[model samples]
Target: MNGRSFSSSVRVGNWNEDVSLDEDLLKDFLEKREKGELLVQRSSNLNKNVLQKAELSISKDGFLHFGEMVMLLNPENSEQSLSNPSPVYGNYTLSVNPDESAIHVKSHLTAPCGVSASSNVKPCGRNAFIITSVDGSEPGEPLCYGQNFALRTTEEFMGHLYLTSDRKSFLKSSKKSHLQEVSLTDQDSFETCWQVVYMDPQLRLEHEGLPIPANTKVLIIHSKTNQCLAVLRKYILWTLFGKECEITAHTYLNGHRVEENENHWIIVTGNPSDDINTMFDRPKPLSEDINGS
Candidate 1:
């Protein structure tokens, strides 16, 4: 998904740089706004930081594309050079083929996924997540419950990961979840862009109400604030058919840690085995301090 480009006249704006969008799509967007069919959400400080660094846009033909969405996972209140603050390292790319209705992901992080052995040069594993639309649906269409397929292909399409509307946490899925992808126009499909963050441990646990320990990470959607958390949990569910489990999520709150109307969720990683309960019972947290240097 490198070197992706956008039409100059499309309705959606690019997050990273100022680009001319499609004229017709822009006109339609204006008409929709005048009719109250389109609502532009105000950007937050977090949104500003991300928008300045990443490129995200929606095409007139309804294709959503993302270019270079990145976040520096530095600790809060850390003193460092403006030119060189060390960031927690991670690389994630989300993309899809035009002829297919599935969303494909390539994720690599500083933390080890345990499924692969580490090397001194590139220690972590290269993992993937695939969310195929439900059955009776054509390729390049939105995914639905019971209609989605997984593991049928050679690729290891894993479990469900849901992002909250507030773009704070990514929730793991339950056995009976209807994992569907939310399109740029709020429709369900393969087109999506998420923001990945390395949060402060204390803040993540306190503000998001998650037991993130130290190394657990998350990703968010770009541009649109209210995109549906894709229901790709079908692959995860299918892969993890039997095991002890617990759901986890990152929920975003409106005010300075307000409790009312707060949004949160919990999703499980699909890598656990039959001995998962025994594994969690020990609770071996990572040894290193991830609160960026």
Candidate 2:
């Protein structure tokens, strides 16, 4: 007689009844649940008013809009390599804080720099950043190409931090010509202003007056220096959050031979509902039936 094959889903006996969880296992599970360590659905804890504001800030088409919380992503550093062994591919977002002193550079200790050591002065040397419109447009207004904006830190305790590039910070090293340091300042000045430019120059006329799509690569130019904002992949700095890539403003030229990819950045934005819900939700109970009833 030929043997018959059974499907994996075929239930021959009461598996649930045959196996049982032990007392220690049950106790551990309960403890984890009580500590909110269990893998379970939870409700959001964000204030209703804040959630409403965030919802209003998001554009209908989901394009990057003014006043929206945005993170600038460097595409060149988005991948893991032998040099960049960190598994945080695409996770190293551009972030900034009020405490500008938190940035510690390895080269600053030895290099004879003209930068001032005043406590009041903060150099944009490899500091974190956040994107916002400088035009004073409404939060829901879409960011258009060639629009002016500021890269600011979320910290407002002392004052708003703006990413600034000026002629004084310009450097000409043996390797290339670029802005040596991008500093942070509490004051809003012309030096802190930057403009968004299309990565492909051909797209300029087509996308004029149109909203910039989220997650698309673009170039940011410092309005004052006329140099493109770039990430110094080789220059890593230590921050309170650990090691992070450095940022600078550089004009890439055929003569200078600077890599153009350094200037490319992607604007990343989160869904308003998801971000709000995750911050302020309550835990949801498990379903009564393991299998659909």
Candidate 3:
């Protein structure tokens, strides 16, 4: 009706009447409907609007910025050995509410290593995350050490899936008693708040206001419980997608001091301007003492 030429004639009823129709338009509509292009086109348009609203950017200083898509990696176990084919070989990345669950159900948070299945497979991108400021900072603001932020899932359909630690998990008397179970929740409660800590002891004192560099190792400490977010190395579990590493909120302690290595994680992003090196070059202490807080 909009632009088609209605010159085609079609038989109508038994009155020998001729009806004018746009054959080309009718054919095009039928083809598009058969191929499901109409639904796809509408979905694509909606995604475009969502992407524009959630436009992410990087900082010139090569630091992790708020609202940027990132993958949390543990370098200690990132590599996969094809010859050995160990369950612990592949790189593990944090993921929230993976699509492995039943319809209308949300899965728990996990660190999936796609390469675990085969050495040829690349690390899974379902682990993508977005670091958003809990203090309502602008998206352009650089994420700094000791700043509180919320890790949110990037899936649009999942709505607001935030990384959260279950308080009830702390009461368990089993082997996992010290480890708080981490999961995805729609609520933005205190359990969703996490603070970034410098992994390097030197940086803890020297770099207070500097933005955390991308691909650098850092500690994510839960604000409410003062526990560090960690991937349970021994707790590999199977999911609908593949084998995934279990995540927890546990404070690794050597006597009264914090054990940094057990909870270390690297922030990986696709921002080309990021500095790939200098992850442990500097550090900053949390605004308040972790134990005292």
- lDDT for 235 in candidate 2 is 59
**Clashes by residue pair, model 3:** 203-282, 203-283, 203-284, 204-283, 204-284
Runs in model 1 with CA error above 4 Å? 1-190, 200-219, 226-254, 257-274, 277-293
Backbone clash tally (model 2) = 12
For 1-293, candidate 2 gives per-residue lDDT tens digits of: 34324432444454343234345578889897786554441111111111122212233585777666555656544333546674323323344421333222211111121111111111122222356767788766777877888876544221346767676432442122244556666677888898877776656668766778876777888898788877655555554334556656775544445336667776655434653421112133366245422
CA RMSD of each candidate after superposition: 23.3, 19.3, 12.3
Name the runs in model 3 displaced over 4 angstroms: 1-59, 77-87, 97-101, 104-125, 169-178, 254-260, 271-293
Looking at candidate 3, the ten consecutive residues that score lowest on lDDT are 113-122
lDDT tens per residue, model 1, 73-111 = 111222222433542222211211111111112221111
Models 1 onward score TM values of 0.21, 0.54, 0.60
Candidate 3 lDDT score relative to the true structure: 0.58
Clash count of each predicted structure: 27, 12, 5
Q: Give a tens-digit lDDT track for model 3, residues 111-168.
A: 3211111111212334556888889899878888878889876664435578777554
lDDT of 1 at 103: 15
Better of 1 and 3 by TM-score: 3
List candidate 2 segments past 4 Å from native: 1-59, 77-91, 97-131, 155-158, 169-178, 253-259, 272-293
